[model samples]
Target: MRLRRSPAAVAAAVAALVVALAGTLTGCGTGERAAADGGNERFTLRIGVIGSGNRLTGPVGYLHDRNALVPLLAEAGVADITVHTFPNGPDLNQALVAGELDLATYGDTPALVARGAGQPTRLIAQAQVGMDAGIVAKKQGGPRSLQELAGRRIATQTGSYMHRYLLGALSDAKVTPKEIVHIYSSDVEAALERGDVDAAAVPAANVEALRAKGYPVIDSLAEDHPAYRGTSATVVTDAFLEARPGFVKVWQAAQVEATRRAKANWDDYLSFAVKVGGFPPEIVRRTTLAEQLPDTPFTEEGLTLLEGTKRFLVEQGFVRRDFAIDDWIAPGARG
Candidate 1:
């Protein structure tokens, strides 16, 4: 999940940019270019990805390392591309705002935050769908219903898409956030294990990990219900698209290929994910790969789900206002 960066993070990104730029101009630092030098075209598409610390990010980084992305990107005239990983939402958003990333995949919240903050960003594509979210507990097993959590402590990251999921879950049960003790993300899972928190919101992989140790899940966001479906996607800066139209088309095509492979050869992809991404085979098997629309179109139905999410956040005061859906989506998206 992504959110607006704190001013401090923004400042740090700016400082880093300044230092990097100075190094490049003075030829003092290790400033490398991602281009095939026939001494002509320099095509580098720098992108922000989730930090290396996360298990999910490993396979994607490997895809790049093994040069799988090179030939694909080359088709789009992006002969050289760099994928930058940040540890958290704030830093990732900060890098995007600072023009560090041409495109990236993130949760709905951060895309809205970037648009709301007047960054020239747009939701251009989808990376995945379907939530892997669930609720876990250590004592008395998992709650059978949301009502069981009355006055119980729950942990989740504030300003996260999971936070929206948690709020939606509470609303589904006619409960309010005020009714539960809210804890931060860093400590949520641990708190649940130690009995400091009664329940914690967890993504699918973590759920599998925790379940191995006997933590029972009370509820899950991965319900078959239509309302709980749909998750994260890709977003890009308008400036980047303007600068490299050829690259954008190729990048989208590459994602389409990946999605096709994911759907058609689920078992193989999962195995590849385990081998390359370092995700355990069990976790890969348990984690749902997002469904692609028939035409693979980023449609109004998709936008509607995101719009509803934004409205939920606004209603809950997570964001200041409800943004026009068109403002966040790209032009010609329906086409």
Candidate 2:
């Protein structure tokens, strides 16, 4: 006593069942998305770095160029990655303030400045430690030593690590300059050549090149004053951290992996540095050798350096307000 349905009726029934199953699957997908993203899905992760040519340098850049972070970030529900480069750290901080970047890796000086200025950013990692800064003067007629630069016009990119080094070294030597003009790092060479600046504070890698070109290196932070060496900071916006809770952990893992690969293939890393930094091979090798990339997000030595830098910035009035370094660091990053 069963009756068979018409062909059209059976077709309609099958279509309805298909729709029901699709709805169930989609509902599950939405639930998973909410759980992963804390109620909203963020598919893009924007990162800022301090460099030109829209290229990221160092171990992070090395891994990024190879797509090594793709799979690692996918675990955190990020499907797209974009990197923006700035000419200096202040520009990078501006992008962060404008809500244009989720994270940034740059000199510690600007990072502290932004934090002191009430920017809600967290220090997620210290990318490199013991970075050196140097001062190069005109060979023809320029100060031969840090003491000689007293009452002379000097140039450095304001709010940069080199700027911090210059101030600290000069203060320690009790020398006051006539002026410290704000010049972009890229234009420092030209300013020196034109005699626009008696000397310029630059990265250590540039010291050798300037010396070869007859520019005399008057002082180096690493050689003359190790206490003033800079460190690179990897920081995340508070909003992004809240949206993507798993990002910091994954990022640190990726950094460790990148460091491993870079060390194993040391020569390849040197080549990468030369290409990205536009420095000679020997300079790259020497500078790279001096930098210590932490296997963990935060090492004792790295944290110590960061604390010292923050204290110096505050004491020197570069940072108007002082904040606890511990509170600024993200959770689970101290290991």
Candidate 3:
């Protein structure tokens, strides 16, 4: 049965919602909030992101960050919400450790690295997962299969997601990094182009771009290993959660709504991304953002990936010890 409210009651409810959001926007659950005359403390949220100049750093991310619902933060009694952007994962992790950023978003592997190193952060939500990632070879080298170039050189950015993906993909094919000439290259594509490396693991977009230029894709990481699926997440500090529980809900709800809207209206979302993110329309059309947001904020499937990533990092000696996945995943954080 459909329930309806009286006009006066509806107006009152709208007014209350506006008041709550107004308060939240004004303060946003920031530092050292004071109790008001009614004995209530304000909430301030301080948000941080990694790097600038990418699609995420520009208009696309902005539309998601500040939208029609964003203003509701002020109504929710939050006074100050500040956003800070760092150049990379390490820098963003540093900001979190120093108590500068209340929330952050980054790849799954890096988050595992941070937690394994004893950083006090928890995965609150997932930003993206299940991307098309793979390894590519220059056309001239013509390495078509994992076994074909057993002794050839491979290139990948050390300690990055692609690095982890390559390691796992090779292991699945019973290939060892030692068997291949491992060359550390700052530029994977450049290394492949110059014939300095036989193959390099990269995102699906890069793979397609390279293949279009006549590069051979030996293996797709996402296709071969379900565990290697993309998983970008949103993290929060314990301190922030303790101070403002309501604001946490607000933030999560906003992200959830954004993801839902983006999915339901995909072409429109991509258009927004291209126009605002500064990405070429062609690139946006070629690459898929259909899996941009996971159905749940965080899922058992994703946490399993986290476990795999942590184990891989520890085994690779990238981190000293492996952290229990449960330690960093706060209960009830996922919706």
Estimate every model's Cα lDDT from 0 to 1: 0.59, 0.76, 0.61
lDDT tens digits by residue: candidate 2, 1-335 = 01121211322333343345444323433233444656346577778998787777778788777787667667776777788998777667766755667789999888887787666688998889888879999766889998899888898877778888888898899998888888887788899988998999998777777877888888988989888788889998666676566778888888888888888888988888898989888878877862477777788887787788788878876666688999999976775
Candidate 1 lDDT over residue span 1-335, tens digit each: 12232422344444456445544322321122222232236567677765464323322343454467667767655666676776545567766755566777767665555555455566767655555577777655545567876666677654456666776787778664323444544456677767776777766666677777787777777672346544565777665554444555566666666566556656756666676545478886767454432225365566667777777756654454457877666766545
Q: How well does each candidate superpose onto the true structure, as a TM-score?
A: 0.76, 0.87, 0.75
In the order shown, the candidates' Cα RMSDs to the true structure are 5.8, 17.3, 13.6
lDDT score for residue 194 of model 3: 79
Off by over 4 Å in 3: 1-46, 54-62, 75-87, 178-187, 275-282
* lDDT of model number 3: 0.61
Indicate whether candidate 1 or candidate 2 has the larger lDDT: 2
lDDT of 3 by residue, 147-218 (tens): 765666676644456667877777677765423333333256677877876888776666777777778888
